[model samples]
Target chain A: MLKYTEDHEWLNLADGVATVGITNHAVEQLGDLVFVDLPEVGAQLAKGDAAATVESVKAASDVYCPLDGEIVEVNEAIVNDPSIVNSDAQAAGWFFKLKLARPADADGLMDEAAYLALVG
Target chain B: MSDTTELGKTPLTALNARIGGKMVDFAGYEMPVQFPEGVMKEHLHTRAKAGLFDVGHMGQVILRAKSGKVEDAALALERLVPVDVLGLKPGRQRYGLFTDQNGGILDDLMFANRGDHLFLVVNAACKAQDIAHLRKHLSGDFEIEELTDRGLIALQGPAAEKALAKLNPDVAAMAFMDVKDVTLAGASCIVSRSGYSGEDGYEISVPAEQAVELTEALLADPDVHPIGLGARDSLRLEAGLCLYGNDIDTTTTPVAAALEWAVQKVRRAGGARAGGFPGADVILPEFERGASRRRVGLAPEGRAPVRGGAVLFADETASEPVGMVTSGGFGPSVDRPVAMGHVATSLSEPGTRLYAEVRGKRLPVTVATLPFITPRYKRA
Candidate 1:
């Protein structure tokens, strides 16, 4: 059960914790992830708000929150080696975990089939 | 507005789109910024293996003397640039600048002697103006021709020679800065053993019709991948190479840009030389006494990348702003962010400490030695 946003963020919600990261398509578009600024733990985030900043070789992009919640954990490993997102964008590349305000918020996100259509 | 045509398209446009290249508008042309492999991968690939680049956007011009003597044409060109064109051997290339009367660089370009004709490559955006300026100043005995329909491709990397040798074995034997007219992949092309990426590479000028075919042929090799403008900038930046408009512009002098090496000593020695070029008065003296501001490399502290237009402070108090960043980005090969800027002469030392004012916060920065990563040009 993977979900996606139009901005290319993917969220995996399980047992009230949602793990998030950018898609492979997004990584390809960004090109050579260099530095990433992760959100502080316990910081409250609203849906569509910027959760982090990712700088690539060419430009910088803002990673938006998929659903309103508070950041509980962040993957610092990816921050040190941003290429993890390029190599394994879906699994180990998870950016952060959010404690969702409501489980229904995840329902609004696009599923794998829907996300594929949007990206295509 | 309706009469104006669309921005020019290179022969590789269709191929780039097919390969999922992220296209962007650059110098009045729609060019790929990067590809599916990403900029970092493409950049490292170029350093380790071979990376192909489409540089057809650059302007190509030919200069021939009406007197039919190569020396006459060389003399005519010497008037505009400070390089000793007469001393340049055929098949060799030299980097130079076209300066205004006040010594400000109008454009930076590469000139090569092709036996009977002199070949020039000017910046894409400045080509029209360059031709107009040369036409206005050049003597009637010299003839100028533009090769707009030709496509330019650069093959760069440590393995570039071996890759190019596979097609034209003679190219591998050519030394640095040498040029040859050869038929590559069945297309007659001008091949030069010079590139901007600080690597042993070749820049091939092919017929427009054969451009895509040549690109496809090269990409078919496992070592060759189509790189985009994004990686090109990073590669040049790592090599401490200047990007014309950003690093050195019309307002920047060659002396300020630390490019005096491009100007020969003989041209600066004589008070009244035979060739009467433009901006001789200002340029000649700067050669003796260095310019006030100099371009230097800066490495900022931490992972926060400093970018262009960021004001640089000389000291800790963040006192008077010394200069600004011209080009700044994360160098994948170097594993850190590097930047180039025009700073005051006193603060241009390799280890001088400085601060960059990013969003009102003074970020610590230090003057670092250039070529942030040493260029791996093949000398032998």
Candidate 2:
């Protein structure tokens, strides 16, 4: 299931794990991504904590954790070449995977249609 | 810094918006932050070929001596700045700084000797204040006329010569720091072989009415791409040029900003015209003894871009900040993070190691040389 956060993060939930990445809207606003700083794979994170950083040629911004979870896996491809995220932010540019503390919390997020409305 | 007040528009605002420019409020003017190509590409494009920028919002003014001599105006102007204005020959422009009475920089500007009159271009945000300052000081001796109806555009990069030379053949003969009156596409323009970008280029000042026509004509050349404010800042930063409010301001002195080169020997302590300018008492001594703090280049260890206001420390465990970053970002040409800041003069040498606090982490940085990239100005 796909969901989005008001902070411009997207989640793709599968079983108890979810793949997290910033939305395309955030990519457009931040301009070209020059660097990405991600958290360790096994770190524990609370909702609203800064989990990652996305830096452009102009400025740097924090990518927040949408839900309390244990970080399961982190993507290293974008770290090597951050422009991968700028080119394809949703799929190949996914930042990390987290084992959710409560799987049911995904229902609280906005769906694709609601997320589009929020951004609009 | 807020948009509550009415925003001012440059002569090329409509054209900028028409070409997919992301317009934002910059110093009260609705300026283009970047175009559809984005800042990264625009910056790289300028370095590779040519990029045209609309700087019409910058303040342009003319200073004429009431006594009918440009030397008199230059001498009167020298009372406020620490530069040798009288020594500047006709058709040459020099960088200047406006100093307050107590050894602080009021503003950094460019002044050109345009034969009978002196042409001055000041920062947009400080223009109104600077005009008031000049009027308060030199109105009785000089006639100051602000050129509100002029449009300033910079055509920059290695290929800039090829593009502009197509319109005016004489431009190819000009060298760096040379300012001349030239005609382009039927518009009478003041062309200067100088720009913020470290590339070989020209800044052409045209009449407001013909601004769009000149901009459009330049873009028609294959080598020319339209650039925005985003690339402008990056280009200048990579070139080690200081932005007025960020690098040097009302609080920083010229010697502290590492701008002693602009102060010619004639204006220094032992010269004939020394000790006449504002703050000469405080600034001149620094020429021999030096300032306690100095501006230097910085290279953050990794890819994370360290930006303005990031506190710098001697080490990760240091409590007090040793200095602070004044201007910084990813240098597209350098292909890495680059920065500049003021640190204690003791640690200002190149190769000195320091740390910048970023996101609760101390990122290691090295004190490097200025102009992250080698300048390609046609000085000869």
Candidate 3:
């Protein structure tokens, strides 16, 4: 299942783990990406806690965690080349994989149709 | 975003929208912050090629003698600013400042001697007050005309001359700071080989209705790309240019701002027209004895950009701030973060190590000479 947060972060959950990344809309709004600072593996994050930071030439923005989890893995590739966040934000540009402590924490998040309406 | 109804639009607003400019509200105007290429790419592209900017929102005013000596209005304007305007030759431009009674800068502007009149271009945000200041100070046989029907455009970069010469061959003959009247695409225009960007470029002032056509003609060249305010700000910052309200304000003087060069010796204490302009009492001594605080360029030790208003400490553990960063950002051309700020005279020397508190962390910064990138001007 795919879930969205008001801060423009999106998560895909399967087998007690979730893949996390910013939405395409958020990437478009941020313009160009120059740097990305992601949380380290084994880092514990609470829902709504900041997990990553994305900086463009003009401004910096924070990416918040949608659900409480322990960071199991981080995408070092995106850190090496930040443009992937702008080019393939939803898939190849994923920020991290987390083991969800409580899977039901994402139940209140918006679905794709609902998220589109919220953004519009 | 406030009420969009209150924001003004430039003549190129429609064109900016068609080209994917992300609009933002600036100085009560709906201006383009950047295009699809984004700020970083646009900034880099300008350094490599030519970039076009719509500066129509900037104020243009003409001061002409009602019926007197041609230098009469020039002499009148000299009373408000601290520049050698009376000695300005025809078709030449000079950077100037409007000073208050307390040796503070009201606004910085560019003025060109056009033989018949003195042409002035001031900051967009300070235009209203600048016009009123001119009217309130000068009372002789002079007429002030706001050229609202005209629009301004800047084509800047190393390749600017090549791109501009394709349309108007005369532009090739104009040297830096030279102003002349020319015809572009059958529309009469006033062109000057000057710009805010630290590059050899031209600023074209044309009839408002014909601006779009002239812009398209410049864009027809392969080397020219339309840039927005985002790149303009970064480019000027990298050049160490002082943004009016940010780097200089009502509280900053020419000496403290490190703009003593603009206040030529001819206008100082011993010159021909000394002590005539405003604030001569306090400003003259600063030239003799340097100011206590001065503006200096700062290169941060790392990639994290130190932003404006960042507090500065003399040492790594100082409890009180010694200065403040007025304009700071990432310099795309230099590939590092650069900044400009006012600091104590003791700490203003080049290579003086200072600490800038950014996001609650103290970052080491080195005081350096202005202009992270050297300016390339075509003087000849």
Candidate 4:
């Protein structure tokens, strides 16, 4: 199931792991992305922790992790071409994959419907 | 202060909306911060081709001499600023700063001697204060006429001349800082060969009612794109121009802002018009001695952009800040993060190393000579 955080990050959970990326709404607000800095593999992160930084020409913003986990994989493609996140923020722009510290933690996040209501 | 409060809109507001401008509230005005092309592309486009900017939010006024002599108005204006206004020839413009009794800057402006009168353009946010200042000081000798019915637009870049000359052939003959009245598309206008972008450009002041048509005419050129306030800030920063509120303020003097060049010899000590303007006691001495701190260019070592208000430290690990970054950003033309701010004179030398604490990380920076991108001004 796909879930969203109040911070505008999205998480997809499967097989005790979760894939995370910024939502389309967040990417739209950020405008054109010029640089992306992601956390390295094996880096530990707490829920709501800043795991990446996305920079546009005018400003920089931190992207927080939705749930606590150890980073098992990172999207090196988005790091190399930051604009990809602006073009395809949901799927190909997935920032990192985390081995969930607690499989049930995803339930605490907002589902797609609730997340849309909050953003609206 | 309420979100429901109406923000001031320029004459080009509707046109901006039609072009898909990303609007934002700036200094109480609903202005476009950027367009769909974004600040980076808009900035690079201005450096490469021509860009049309709606500068109508700037305050334009005419100071007419009550006694029918231009010197009367010049002398009245000289009392507020340190620049030598009496020496300004007809059709020529000069950059000036309004100084307080303490030698601090009140506002920076461009004043053009229009033969019989003086034309002044000041920052929009400070317009009320500037006009009131002029009235309080010079109302006795000058009639200050606020040109609220006019609009201002700037055509800037390497291709600016080529683009503008197609519509007004007289623009090709105008030299830098030259201001003259011309007719564009049958609309009487005042065109000045000067701008804040540090490029060879022209600022056209037109009738507010005809601003849309004039803007549309310029935008018809293939080289000209509608640039917004976002690229405008970055472009001026790259050129080392000072934004009144960001780079300079009520506490900063022309000497401290590295704007002593704007102060002519006649206004300095031992000159013909010495000590006549406000704060001469403290400002004139800075010419002989020096200011304790000066504004200088800062080039960050890496890609992480350090924005304004970032505290600067003397060493990488030092907690005490020696200065602050007044204006910092990514320079699209330079392809790096460039900044400018005040620093102790001891640390103001080019190539001097310093550290800026950006997002809790200490980033290395070097004090470099200004104009991160060299100005491509056309001089006669």
Q: Pick the candidate with the highest lDDT.
A: 2
* Candidate 4 residue-wise lDDT, B270-340, digit = tens: 88988788898989999878898999999999877778999999998777788899998888888778899
Top TM-score prediction, candidate number: 2
Full candidate order by DockQ, most accurate first: 2, 1, 4, 3
Candidate 2 regions exceeding 4 Å error are B1-4
Scored by lDDT, model 4 comes in at: 0.90
What tens-digit string does per-residue lDDT give for candidate 2 at A22-74? 99999999999999999998999999999999999998899999999999999
Q: Give RMSD to native, each candidate.
A: 3.0, 1.0, 2.1, 1.8
Per-residue lDDT of model 4, residues A1-120, tens digit only: 999999999999999899999999998788778778889899999987889998887888999987889999999999778889989999999999999999898889999999999989
Q: Mind giving the per-residue lDDT tens digits that candidate 3 earns over A33-117? A: 8778889899999988888888777777888888889999999999887889899999999999989999887788899999999
By lDDT, the candidates rank as 2, 4, 3, 1
Report DockQ per prediction, comma-separated. Answer: 0.63, 0.90, 0.53, 0.59
Deviation of model 3 at A100, angstroms: 4.0
User: What lDDT does the true structure give each of the candidates?
Assistant: 0.86, 0.93, 0.89, 0.90
Query: For residues B72-188, what per-residue lDDT tens digits would candidate 1 score against the true structure?
Result: 888888888877888889988888888888878889898899999899999988999999988988848889999977999999998888888878788988888898898889999
- Model 4, residue B163: distance off in Å is 1.9
As a whole number from 0 to 100, the lDDT of residue B39 in candidate 2 is: 95
CAPRI verdict (incorrect, acceptable, medium, high) for model 1: medium
C-alpha lDDT of residue B1 in model 2: 50
Best by DockQ: 2
